[model samples]
Target: MARTRLLFACLALATPLVPATATAAPLPASGLVLSVRQEMGTFSTTQLSCEPAGGLHKNAKEACAGLAPVEGDFTKMSPGDAMCTMELNPTKATLRGKWRGKKVDFQEVFSNPCVMHVNTGKVFEF
Candidate 1:
């Protein structure tokens, strides 16, 4: 009984040292923030809200339509047929925010803006 009591005392002390866990809040139903940065330090960003399809994006409806087919998987987006020069301008693309209640965070670097546009299509054309 003395050994059991000692173990219980040790556990009681250790419990206070354990770190508390934090739960992340659930993501919004449908929205995304898209951006692109160029090697020259120029960048642009825009908000995109789907479902009803509206935001600061120039063509939110078209962008959302393209995303729907891929279910928000940017990597799986069909590449467009736009021809691009081989110049290495170094453009970085990013996408973050929620889509259909799912969280999304994506980033990629391309040779140039043309390549980024061809790869991402209307979703990042804002």
Candidate 2:
């Protein structure tokens, strides 16, 4: 009985010294963030420097961009028979692709303020 009591007392004393751990809340589906370092394109490439916002940029100043869930969830993006064609310009970037028999277009209204040279009319098959 005495040994058991001593163990209980030691446990009680040590309990106060234990640090509390913080639990982080999960990200929302509509606002999910993807930290993409660069345009995940063809197998081989040199490098390009740009970054995106929305808490998904790994390195905002070093070729890190983000994919945010605006109209759809990230899980909804399945890897299938889809072809993405990009058009690069001095002022804008346009992306058009066909996924699941539906045509989709994404336009980047704002160009990279730092001005990274991106190739135009490149088709990436995912």
Candidate 3:
């Protein structure tokens, strides 16, 4: 009788931890927060939300359009038609957040700000 009572108590304690439904919580449509850091240590950040295209980014609409072709895959972005110098002023860009309800994390380093812009276009233009 004591073992049965203990088992019931343990089961009661563990029940709440289980989800009532199999479906997970819904995710936001699309969003991403990005940052860029120069070799000199200065950095800038911006937020981008797609679909309706609104955020703190100065070129949110263009950025969203740039991301659309690549489906938010930064590495697949087409290089812009910009002539960059061979200057080696390293810069790092990072993004973290969600895209189309899926989590995303990305990072990359470029030879310079100009190169960064050439590679990522408006997505990192902030």
Candidate 4:
């Protein structure tokens, strides 16, 4: 009975030392934010930060890698021939964020999702 009482006292004292609310560390500096809009008007968003890429993008790693070479310049990216149908479908993509510490804002329209995927690499494959 004495040991149980002592144990209860210890737990009671320690409980007060613990915080009722816990806090999480702040999010790291986000380097990039990308938005993709398909021809049908549906859209998706993603983010890439400092080094590790994240968010809802299908190929965050590949997208980030593709962005690095162009430093976020949409025009500089090569639009490879994606062997898509001759349809004139269009898709638009936009990005606003920092790249290697420099502010970046980019927007471009591709012939179609297939063309965009092949030309833009994974940057628009969300």
Candidate 5:
């Protein structure tokens, strides 16, 4: 009788209060996965780790394809009307697009697994 009660209690406690799948969507872009995101005067990229593909130098080309970014003007236009483009190679990542007739460039790092880093005017390591 005691074993049965304990088992039932354990099962009740194990029940999930909320569904596990209710979390936000995973970041669309990943290492070497080139993605574009734009807002007002700035465009940014999703930082991805290149470790899973056997390191950056070896798999840089393949990883670059997974990087995804979203582009749009938050105040002026819809997402479809914005223009954003990225060029990433084994060496650097470059972003170019027009926001309300102004140019915006954004960059980020994918090299280390410690933390995400972003910069402008230079190609970052992945």
Candidate 6:
């Protein structure tokens, strides 16, 4: 009886507790994996989170905030309205993460860092 009680207690402890006032729709998971290859030929990988404000990103909070609006879609983050210079600078980016329990895989190439920064905001600033 004691062993059974202990097992039950352990199982209870392991269970995640949902808030009583949770939103009607489930929110996305708060994690991201980003890879960026800059125009200067340097590469960097960043991890980010929205809730905890933690990650490898130079501006973790701002990066996560920037990511939240686009719902983890790199294609959506691209700003077509940006008026960038004619320079041939290029940057490659990849992003993989979970949002609303769905898998996201995105890859993109920016014509220049100016375009990248204008469009992507703080997401790839690191």
Ordered by lDDT, highest first, the candidates read: 3, 1, 6, 4, 5, 2
How does residue 17 of candidate 2 score in lDDT? Answer: 34
TM-score of 2: 0.20
lDDT of 3 by residue, 1-126 (tens): 964564355334322233767667543377787778899667677677787677778999999899888888887898979899999889998876777878888899999999999999889987
Give the Å shift of residue 106 in candidate 5.
0.9
Query: Which of the predicted structures, 2 or 3, would earn the higher TM-score when compared with the native?
Result: 3
Off by over 4 Å in 2: 1-68, 71-90, 111-126
Q: Considering every candidate listed, which one attains the maximal TM-score? A: 3
RMSD of each: 15.4, 19.5, 13.6, 16.1, 20.0, 11.7
Every model's TM-score: 0.74, 0.20, 0.76, 0.67, 0.18, 0.66
Instruction: Give the number of colliding residue pairs in candidate 4.
Output: 1
Error of 1 at 73 (Å): 2.0
lDDT of 4 by residue, 1-126 (tens): 964564455334322232447565434343566667778766666555535665556687888788777877755888776488867778887777666667778888877778777778877776
Tens-digit per-residue lDDT, 18-55, candidate 1: 23575554333567777788996676777777887877
The parts of candidate 3 lying over 4 Å away from their true place are: 1-28
Model 1 pairs whose backbones collide: none
Error of 5 at 60 (Å): 20
lDDT of each: 0.76, 0.27, 0.77, 0.66, 0.30, 0.68
Give the per-residue lDDT digits (tens) of candidate 2, residues 56-98: 2233232222222222222223233434345342233333222
Structure candidate 4, residue pairs in collision = 80-119
Model 6 TM: 0.66
- Model 6 segments more than 4 A misplaced: 1-28, 78-83
- Report the lDDT of model 1 for residue 94: 79
Clashes of 5: 14
Candidate 1 TM-score, C-alpha based: 0.74
Backbone clashes in candidate 1 total: 0
